[model samples]
Target: MFVRIVKMSFHQDKIPVFLEHFHSVKEQIRNYPGNNFLEVYQDKSNPGIIFTYSVWNDETDLENYRHSDLFKEVWTFTKTLFNDKPEAWSVDKLVTLG
Candidate 1:
């Protein structure tokens, strides 16, 4: 399994725009091929900082999604709202608990 995390910081006023865009695409992202899970988190002290956590079956699956048109569309909209460059990490899971 592959785990991906992305941290995005938006302009304070652009947060709502980001959220609206996220709401529109969240389902498409979750339903995309080989995706296993998706979650969104917000920083406790910084409302404009957000994180996306997702799991994919493998790197190829993740790449496929990255290359998809949906990603292009979403990312184009997303990057415009950023206050700072986004950061992302992809890794193999070390452990899990719930």
Candidate 2:
């Protein structure tokens, strides 16, 4: 599996709106095919910053989701609230220590 991380910074006033939209669609995203896990985090020091961490079976799965209508809808609304350009990374798991 591979991990995907997206960091987004939103306008201060848009944080709550973004979170409301996220809560409404998070379940659908988590249940999408090839998705193994999904979680969201807000920076403790910066409430306007958010990060989405997800695991997928492979790149193809991730790409499919990115191209889906669900993503299109989510992104369209999400982009409008951004205070800065989003950053994303897809990386292979190196190791996990308990």
Candidate 3:
């Protein structure tokens, strides 16, 4: 499996708007092709910082989703509220726990 992590920092007041938008389409993203799991994390010390952690079946699957309409729509809204450059990376799972 391949994992994708995206870290984004948003304007404090925009957090609610962003979360509302995410909640609107979270289910569709979860069910996208080859998607295995998805989760959003927030920094306890800095609530404005958010992270998207997801598992995909492979690189191709991830690429497919990135090129799809879902990404376009979701990202369009997401980018507008970002206070900092969102950092993203792909990785392999080296260890796991519940």
Candidate 4:
């Protein structure tokens, strides 16, 4: 499995807009092929900082999603609300416990 995490810092005032956009597109993302999970989180200490945590079948699946038109549309709108450049990570699972 592949794990993807994206850290986004938003202009404080633009958070609402970002949330609205996220809600609108989140389902599509979660349902996309090869996606096992998707979630959005806000930092407790810094509300303006948000994170997207997702699980994909593999790196190729993640890359395909990134190249999809849906991603382009979402990212184009999302970048405008950022206070800083976003950071992303795609990693293979080392271990898991349930």
Tell me, by lDDT, which candidate is best.
3
lDDT of 2: 0.96
Stretches > 4 Å off in candidate 1: none
Backbone clash numbers for all candidates listed: 0, 0, 0, 0
TM-score of every prediction relative to native: 0.97, 0.96, 0.97, 0.96
Compose the digit string of candidate 2's lDDT tens values, residues 42-70: 99999999999999999999999999999
Candidate 1: C-alpha lDDT: 0.95
Off by over 4 Å in 3: none
Write one digit per residue (lDDT tens) for candidate 4, span 1-48. 999999999999999999999999999999988999998999999999
Candidate numbers, best lDDT first, in rank order: 3, 2, 1, 4
lDDT of the candidates, in the order given: 0.95, 0.96, 0.97, 0.95
Off by over 4 Å in 4: none
Candidate 3 per-residue C-alpha lDDT over 1-98 given as tens digits, one digit per residue, 9 for 90 to 100: 89999999999999999999999999999999999999999999999999999999999999999999999999999999999999999999888888
RMSD of 2: 0.8
Listed per candidate, the RMSD to the true structure in angstroms reads: 0.7, 0.8, 0.7, 0.8
Candidate 1 clashing pairs, residues 3+ apart or interchain: none
